[model samples]
Target: MVQKDMKLWPFKAIPTADGDNFKKIVIVVTYKGEEKQFALEEISSMLLIKMKQILETYLGSEVKNVVVTIPAYFNDAQRQATKDAGVIAGLNVMRIINEPTAAAIAYCLDRQCTSNGATKNILVFDLGGGTFDVSLVAIKKGVFEVSGDTHLGGRDFDNRLLSHFIAEFERKHNKDISANRRAVGRLRPALDFSCSITRARFEKMNKELFQDCMLPVQMCLRDAKMEKSEIHDVVLVGGSTRIPKIQQLLQEVRDPHVFSLHNIPPAPQGVPQIDVWFNIDIDGILTVSAELVGTNNKNQITITNHSGRLSK
Candidate 1:
């Protein structure tokens, strides 16, 4: 603080837990950059308390109408849990929008475009930290309508890549990490970092880590049902997607038509266009409160509510 010549730290830390994995993160968005950290604690309650202090200190007052964005595929329990966290912190959450929807809203504002006209279908393919979502929407007269959606996110890919690494590591080092709990825990960060960086540049760091972990990466992409040319553009989103190997994979799939396929589309002349935003770090989930929720993992298209009314 003294060295930086700053008065206050605008960011606060939050603890996140995924399965048995626990991390402490201090997140603060500023004019300079955003900070996401790894917390080194195990207890969930302790993390929550620390987060409350951080929020209070940063805001310098009670929070009002907090906007919590989450995944579209999240169950009711998960959604309620998030809201409960906010309540624990003494905040009234006005609404919880999906991350992608928030990004889209920001994108629209940044581009000076309005969703007020004839219905246009848009496909939001959001790949995030742990999950992925594919949303089809119909925008008309300032309202966004959902047509369809799906989820096959980064977590699945990570698991696939990790499995690949374990197999290769055992074959080469004769050391089975998948069976060793301690080593498996250690291996997670390495694999995530290595795969992430490989998408940007095959630096020495990634090479040293995943030199033998090839088959898994190949298989994961294959499981995605994506080939060199099949994916017109591998819209890079989520922190994992930043890996240089990923970019390479996407590049190899292209037909020397990077511009026509990979590049973001340009805006229309008079009808201003918003840049389709996708986060390459976190998952973007939009919330929809309905009477029904899905209980199965195979999230097939099934509508729960039917009023039996259709109008032209």
Candidate 2:
């Protein structure tokens, strides 16, 4: 069940390598006093089933159809695996959308557009829990054109931190906890044994990883055939974006234009604030409407076409 001699699945291969040429991955687990073998997708399905139950409970309805968001760099096989996981969980996978694309859509829908109706080229820097994606998106007349993607993210930083502390723990206490999962887990919770880390030191430790984040940004600009100055806005998405160093690096890339779209500024006194609302219907059409708080002034745009070719 280990398939130790078989080649590991190449999930990151662009234009994913043909699955037929590789052996399937399986793992053995003891269940009810018996050994059971399960494929990787089956295990993934089990997790998805639990997630579905939670979602159903929250929504108070039986759910079936789902739209899965994946990393922008995911190839056909990876996307198909995601769909299969959903299917195995007893849900119909409606559509697979790129994570960056989805973030860009939400940004466009909620953003306050200039009255001139000029097209804006925005860079989306999405560094989520496990994967990072950078996309150069051109929003014109409710259409989105995307470019660039990446796979590095917050998990790499966590791994680096863990390694640093483990080494420190070994030096101080003369104990090797690297091979001890329980010890490592305890260390992660509190680092209880008189160890400390400063922001500067933490940033220094992961300096290379921080610098690597810029590569995708540069690639996105080149692939889009646009200069850094052309990026009207730099939108940061995901929890990892809150990192000060990450924000600083983004500012260095797009100096004055770097801003978190998630932060809503307070409206000035007596000023009529525009309330923008976004809604995506069942058919994948996005409708954005804006209304003046104290007046009847309103405008709306509906994006019917969600398909676009990413820059190569």
Candidate 3:
């Protein structure tokens, strides 16, 4: 038996353009599971340092090429920004893969799907901590090809959930949480985390996170037109997916067919409120920049995507 020592770690960062709020950073290590956290100010830098420290402590290997996953809907600037993040982490940029593509790659690696060369058109629905990406991929033998894809992701679900929380909390506490970013910021993770876990056992672990969060979740689940026991085999990709609420919810919503919970949460109609935000005319509801790492690359950065280049 040949001992395989190859390891690949994929990193992802999800930023909300609406409030310039960055939600989480995730790293999928080959055979080592995942490391994730919600990012704070200068988080990209702090995250890079943390990654280096983790690599030093855990792998005892020098950092080499890394695959950074960005949203498919992200423009050149957004992609560039993602690359810059990699550079900061002291990694030799291998390729800037879409979140869905990276996810499919992760799945392939995890499942050992690419031993030889085989081609198959696989549909990948990736709902991350902050964004959602739906992709159609052509895997030939071993070389994976990403065909069509869209960016309708998890953050949208969070926003929807956040809105629901605000409304519900206001009704209960008689105070608007939305207006208070601090409170919303603090409570958002707990509520968001619980909403993902639909498993019954999960309820026992994180009780407080779901105290006032249940009605909103139930309502959102209803609005999504799904019920418990309907979810199964949903690829729960991001940190948020680990939340028992999501797992539980998917169990209810995608019942019968097991939710993968392996890839990003697929854009089931009940999950992302796409129609409300996506304006076909504008190409996307909001624009993201893919930045290149260079000097003076502070806020006023330049990014290039498939569309073109933009100066920020």
Candidate 4:
């Protein structure tokens, strides 16, 4: 919400369990000479209301049931807060789902994109604006299980950019622009004429942050009892995944060999070479290469799911 030219936003954090998560952020709005306080839940409710209005306009009817997705790392308080937002929005939220789990379900189950009677391990690297999550999910037998991290995300990258830009500005003008909101607004547009940091420059400036992106992924994989090489496919989800640097960091989730299907186990001795090779392309189709044990014969097949979509 805004009054005059000033916008309302969360101004302070309210601690939740473990002091790592926020229960409810404090939203402060200054109107006249007085300040008003609102819970972050209220802000969420307002957003939800607007979203519902948009959906209703499109469908030309009332839509109530909602399956809201939240970060996999949300604590019980945060999850309940989201539900409260739904109630305030006048919508019946049927379920609160982990964002990564929802992404995996949509990518595989809803689309029926899975292999034929075979289980596949998936690494879901979700890099969002505020929070990053790395989920190791196994989809099989009509079930899915996941392990994830909630503390890391694109906000870290954003901070890196801010620091780099601010340093460049300070070096040129010898002034601190942190408190200068108007100047900050012009930072991106004024880039061409200024010392605008390039992607490579930003990556170099914040190398630690770039590498930190993978810590959760490695932890989740260990928890899931899987090796990175065993993952059949890596699904990229969330807006932060759009960054080239982020994409590079997340490619580890993708069977870097998925395109080549080179996770080969040794063949038995005293026998001709037999190879099991499968390549999973961006289209989610898996193509397997099978070499006959004796001669120079090669066999291959394209695997698809019930919906006629390529198995991820």
Candidate with maximal TM-score: 4
Cα-based RMSD of the predictions, in order? Answer: 19.3, 13.4, 22.4, 9.2
Provide the clash count, candidate 4: 3
Worst 10 residues of 2 by lDDT: 5-14
- Let me know the TM-score candidate 2 reaches against the reference structure: 0.67
TM-score of predicted structure 3: 0.44
Relative to the unseen true structure, what is the C-alpha lDDT of residue 52 in candidate 2, on a scale of 0 to 100? Answer: 87
Better of 1 and 4 by lDDT: 4
How does each model score on lDDT?
A: 0.43, 0.67, 0.45, 0.66
Error of 4 at 21 (Å): 19
Superior candidate under TM-score, 3 versus 4: 4
| Candidate number achieving the greatest lDDT relative to the actual structure | 2
Q: Each candidate's TM vs. the true structure?
A: 0.44, 0.67, 0.44, 0.68
**Model 4 C-alpha lDDT per residue in residues 135-227, reported as the tens digit of each score:** 777777422434454545665665556656767778888987756544554563454326645656777877886777777777777776767
Q: Which stretches of candidate 2 lie over 4 Å from their true place?
A: 1-21, 26-38, 112-117, 141-151, 189-194, 256-312
User: Which residue ranges in model 3 land beyond 4 Å of their true spot?
Assistant: 1-43, 62-65, 110-118, 141-151, 190-236, 239-312
> Which parts of model 4 have CA positions greater than 4 angstroms off?
1-24, 31-34, 109-111, 141-149, 180-195, 256-312
lDDT measured at residue 96 in model 3 versus the true structure, 0 to 100: 78
lDDT of 3 by residue, 165-221 (tens): 566677777876565544666666664323343334444544443332233334433
